[model samples]
Target chain A: MSFTLRFGPVFEAWRELAAGVWLTLQLSASAMLIGLLVAVVCAWAKVFGPRWSGWIVNVYVEVIRNTPFLVQIFFIFFGLPAAGIRLSPDVAALAALVVNVGAYATEIIRAGIQSIHTGQIEAGLALGLRPVQVFRLVIIKPALRAVYPALTSQFILLMLSSSVVSAISADDLTSVANNIQSRTFTSFEVYIVVTLIYLVLSLAFAGAFRAIDRRVFSYPVAR
Target chain B: MTRFPSRRALAGLALSAALAVGLSARPAAAQTVDEIKKKGVLNVGMLVDFPPFGITSLDGKPDGFDADIAKELAKSLGVRANIVPVTGPNRIPYLLTGQVDVLVASLAVTPERAKQVAFSDPYAGIRIVVYGKVGAAVKEPADLKKFAVGVARASTQDVSLSAIAPEGTNIRRFDDDASAVQALLSGQVDVIGAATPVVGEIEKIAPKGAFDTKITLREQVHGIALRPGQDDLMKAVNAFVAQQAASGALNTTFRKWLNTDLPELKKPAI
Candidate 1:
């Protein structure tokens, strides 16, 4: 079972691997940002929009939640081309990730939006805040604060899930590992290294989110 | 304190002995044939959508060279063949984990793979060809350094591409021929290294005059893979191949799948 592991090729491909990690981080960050926006819009629509709009949003979330991410990725990558909507591998993978993550985010954000006490809305109205303004300042911020941890966790999961994009040839971290392992015939070794790198990235993201949480909810500690 | 610890220590020792005995007494896993005979089904792992090798046809049934081989092999063993699709990265894992007995997924017998699994004597010889953009500068393996290359992930073609492709050649690896071709057609890569049939399939999907053939990378033998130490299974497979070759059934099967008469694959010494 023991074999000499080749470190030369892995080291030589360090630049490519770094580029892949950078790409994965960029993809995850961009998708999370865009997914957050989509989540907000969908959550708001469910809470305040017409009955039909709520139904549509619910359907979107349900379908996405029920289906596997692999199938969704396949549909976007393979199905879209037939429908005359083609995207580059990176664009396609990123688009699929955003859509998948946004659905999960929608549920998380909606729960937060619902938890906003009726008293807050009433206070906003009393102060002559417009409906939109009340929703933005009074409801949105506190809801976001309460659900920030869960939402950030989902974002981290999305970052880790970005490994699947390698199937579509996005040249992300896992793809680089695949190439390295095949060349070196050290599949287990390559995966172990990749898992370590992923752990580091996860910790980094967690630290970043903690910093953001402190800055955003700087008013006081809730006892 | 020592007096009380003695009883606890004795209990811990007894527990540890029981655990060790229980673990060691576990039965060894049965072989694929043994399980198949008991269950009355021979499970076969294959590539579900790779034409000419293994594929699930439009009718929702498995077909192709590997599928046919599996069916015949199972019939010889007096068990019904149950086909299961497997991707390249997963095939070996599935075989080792007993998720599938044998992987007839056009698995090439490499020295690296031979360590973890047993391969039947070569039943087919797969030719690796490089398809590049027509009039492209890559007319040979040496030219691959100057051009970007795409290849199916974990395929022999990928190995060849990595070896022959110059440093910084930007070799893009996809999970299948389809995506690799997609990359090539989109100009993401200037060349695609794959099996001859795969290259043919890619050229069909791409624009007119999109593909040009370069040098062949290794047209080595391919074999069905089983878990290592499956001596009985190996002997059975080799016997089947030998029988098929003697009966000229091997050539017929080749023609049925590849749609061409490849005499080289008409069952060599098994």
Candidate 2:
């Protein structure tokens, strides 16, 4: 028996793959930005806000982190329609990604926040800096810098996990690759190309994160 | 530095080499009725997920129309039936690779498949239909425009529906029929491309008259598939099918599972 790899058909459907890649980028980028905001707020609530708000944030994090992303997405896409909350597949996918990453990032950012020295915060306050300013400039800046690597890695994972959104027919990169594989019956070639695309995308993201780290977190820190 | 293959190219080479070795390692052979009888067990491949025709029984055994037929065939051949579960995509490979003597896996007979495996007389049939909510205004394939359709990816329904869907028809392909039906039931898609028995399953769970068959897509016949050159086994299987049809055993099984009389079974012209 002889087997040959035919990548011609896979490359011919480049337009669909390109669209899928674009959607993946859009979903990941938007989810990262919004999820970061969510994580920051939740972290603050857990560490400094009122006890009731902290408890609520704790519940949200536990629920999202405990369940599988596939089930969460299914509940939002399929289960929510019963409550008159029917979201389109792409929107549901984005919502799931945001909710999922937000929880993990909350725990990561919380650890970073706790690592911030109490003396530094007090010194900022004593220098006539307002509470909000002290928290944002003195606490959050260093906290984010300390946890930058973990946060970026989580973002990359969120991008990879976005592939499962195709379960709801969200038409992400993996879904498009599957569609092509089915059409062409060139499963190996299609998957190989998709794997390369994902690898390149991950590297590009990692490189971008590194560039951001050098530019934003370059300030000297006392030992 | 000496020139070397890029890492990407090296990875591609290694993957292709591995796949080539794996694919070529399988030794293909056709099984005769005598060999199966000598072994005292007929390794019959059938699907476990597809309902009515193929399904897992409450006792965790394979039990359905296909399973019954496989057992009857084995009994007629004086051999015990060893039902090995197979999936839609790999049923033919199971037959060709000698993993199973024959496939009663609800595999639809088509010309493309005819080139790969020999098909006996169709033992069962299913009607693929465009089933949907009662209120949808879909009357024909052309009228499917602006409607969101769900189908199991790479299925017969997906292939057939993609053929006639209008330019604006929104077809969402799920991983399998269950998921596609889920999308339709949950209002994720306006309609779905599914088989009659699947629609029957949906009717049991969904409210009465909530959905109906919008349009018939294709009536696909399933055959017992054997490795391409198994003329002797093919004849024996066809004889068994003829005897069963004459005895009304096939119809009885059909009624037990699908609650309907067996439609006239015809060997599709390939």
Candidate 3:
């Protein structure tokens, strides 16, 4: 079989495609960091804050987790502009990803918080640690260690799901592949190349997560 | 140790790859007048999703300006017009693969396309223009620098608008012309880049004096496309187009569907 695959045009547009990959990387990375913070806050609120605040967090998490990401992104990009809150595609995409990943991460992080033994927190309090210090020292750090794998996997899934933002004309890697395929009409070749790029990106992210895991979670306990 | 592809899977992959290569090597089948006559049916590919020029009638059959033109061409050849629905991206491939005898899909006569399919004399024309809400103060492409302009993704209008728009112009791309028009109506976008026919439909619903054409981007003339080297069929199709244009029949059809007289077609130089 002598089928020719043309990478010439796809590579010639590398600058734009590389820019698209970079944007996807930046968008997802920022969303992961910010969304993780939101998750931590919401999970903490649900477990320890007032009942009314916990109720609000529960509703936010459920509403976001139940709805499709496509609709969520559309609402942020297309729906919110009606309320005089216009946002650029990249910013809107980032907001939507953070909103989505934060909800799912909230549930995962809550499970992490719940797994902490009550005695550990009580011991910190007995030692006269402040409430914030007790939470940091007794609950959160160990809880995060307990659930780090689940949280990181959810983040990788978020990175993949960010492809949906192309529907709103965000210059992500998938959109770049789409434009290239449409212009070149080499649909097969373009998709193959893009699929490989996405694979490499996922593996790279996995490796980075592993490196972070070694640095943060590998220490032996001070028994 | 089991090989990764597991022999069976490897064979299947090889078979599919061979089939794919074999399909690409298909020689262009030259559609001829006599073959269509023998079949007693002319398969004319036209787009159904595009309005005015191509649309599905209330009866669930393709019927529009392009459909009417296809009917008249088939009538001239004394054959039934089998209206085959085709999309914009696949129309040329359909013609090249001999899946459809001819295309009346509102395909613009572009130099890049000329290499693939032989086009007849110009049969229809469309003018793409930037339109917006009235008093938007958008006079030219440069004036659009500050506004959010929406166009259907990768459409002819999108390409043209991108070429003329300044770097600061934010061109939002919707999935199709309908969505782009919806964006304008919903006030989601400040302006739209679309063809005149789509703009005409928008004008029917949008209040009069509420929207106006900002600037004409480019005028494109469409032609019937036949497979390459279908010289006889190509000549016959061109002759039919000339008759339709001269007798005012095409204009009447245009008015019936488009609610306007046919735009004058300036046929490209042979």
Alpha-carbon DockQ of candidate 2: 0.44
The candidate that achieves the highest DockQ relative to the unseen native structure: 2
Question: Model 3, A47: alpha-carbon shift in Å?
Answer: 3.7
Say which prediction, candidate 1 or candidate 2, comes out ahead on TM-score: 2
Best-performing candidate as measured by lDDT: 2
User: In order, what DockQ does each candidate have?
Assistant: 0.27, 0.44, 0.29
Flag the better candidate by lDDT, 1 or 2: 2
Question: Candidate 1, after superposition: displacement of residue B229 in Å?
Answer: 3.6
B98-210 in candidate 2: lDDT tens per residue? 77888988888877677667899987888999999999888889988868999987677888899999876789988767778889989989899998998888999999989
User: CAPRI verdict on model 3?
Assistant: acceptable
lDDT of 2 at B152: 84
lDDT: worst 10-residue window of model 1 chain A: A1-10
- Cα lDDT of candidate 3 equals 0.85
Clashes of each: 0, 0, 0
- Say which prediction, candidate 1 or candidate 3, comes out ahead on DockQ: 3
Between candidates 2 and 3, the lDDT winner? 2
TM-score of 2: 0.85
